[model samples]
Target: MQRVLIVEDDPLIAIDLQHMIHDLGYVTSGIANSFDSAKRLAPHSDLALVDVNLVDGATGPRIGQFLAGEFGISVVMVTANPEVVADGIFGVIGVISKPAQPATIKQVLEFMSTYKHQLVAHPPALRLFTCDRRGPL
Candidate 1:
């Protein structure tokens, strides 16, 4: 199962995205309203649904960069801002428009399903962490 982390500030949206992830047979690791919580969970996540703007106005691109570069988690950016996605966005595998629908979220999962192996640091690393999903993580 894919260990997915949601980085959305809106509680309802977070819940909805979490459900969408589960429907796709992926497990949600956590919910992060800000970049800090997101970064803290990146080490364990395989896929991330990152919002472009957080509570503090910080952008998700920063979080996306960290997830891909440091933690190796695949990132899917959800944004309504064109400028936010403009010119040389890196690390994220795909972009979804804001108010992301179930289908859009599903597509993101499809994009991430390919990298589920990275969700775990290593085969033996499973003994070192607790996975939210069943099976060997």
Candidate 2:
């Protein structure tokens, strides 16, 4: 199953994401509220729900980059930051708006579930496998 990390400082949001992941057929791998903790914990996830603004600062873009670029974790940036700054999250599969709707969340989770690799400390570096390539590749 897809393993997910929640990098949201808001406990309620994190818990909601956890519940949603369960409903979507994934596991809650970990949760972090800051950039440092997210960095340490992200490598363990196959995918991540990253908030652009953290309890400490705006670290979601960084987390998104690190998770996707370094660890091969599929990052779905969940934030209210509709600014172009959202464009900076390289290697990210999607940029989801905050207060995620069940429909949108399910869409992203369904996107992730198609991949076959099991989540571990670090997923294998297969660029295509690590990405969301549509339509029977």
Candidate 3:
């Protein structure tokens, strides 16, 4: 099972995401409300569902870049303002507009599991980002 880390500031949303991840048969590595907490849990995570705005301000993109570039973890931004990361960040696979539906999350996980973060045909619910000239790796 994929070990997922929820990088969201809202406790309620984090809890809901945790439950959804569990229901989908994935492991909840941890939930982090700030960049410091997220860094601490990055090593143990396989994937991260991140929010653009957090308790520490707009640090989700940085978190995603860090986790994906440093730890080789797959990163997906889940935020109310998807436009913030519309241009994309290094190591981030894509952006999922909030509120993300259960079906969308499930499909995202499945796609990530199958592709292992490779740039390929992605789920329609996910807005793919152009991480680099070659695309997300």
Candidate-wise lDDT, in order: 0.69, 0.70, 0.87
- Name the TM-score of candidate 3: 0.92
With a 3 Å backbone cut-off (N, CA, C), the pairs that clash in candidate 2 are none
- Best first by lDDT, ranked: 3, 2, 1
Candidate 2 at 109: error in angstroms?
Answer: 1.3
- Model 1 poorest 10 in a row by lDDT: 123-132
TM-score of each: 0.77, 0.77, 0.92
The candidate that achieves the highest lDDT relative to the unseen native structure: 3
Clashing pairs in 3: none
lDDT per residue (tens digit) for residues 1-137 in model 1 = 77999998888888988888888778999999898899788877988878878886766878877787777787767766635565424666546666767776675576466545454222111111122222232
Per-candidate Cα RMSD to the true structure, in Å, reads 10.0, 7.1, 2.0
| Model 1 ranges with Cα > 4 A deviation | 115-137
Badly placed stretches (over 4 Å) of model 2 are 84-86, 115-137
**Model 3 lDDT tens row, 7-87:** 999999999999999999999899999999999999899888999999999999998888888888888899999988878
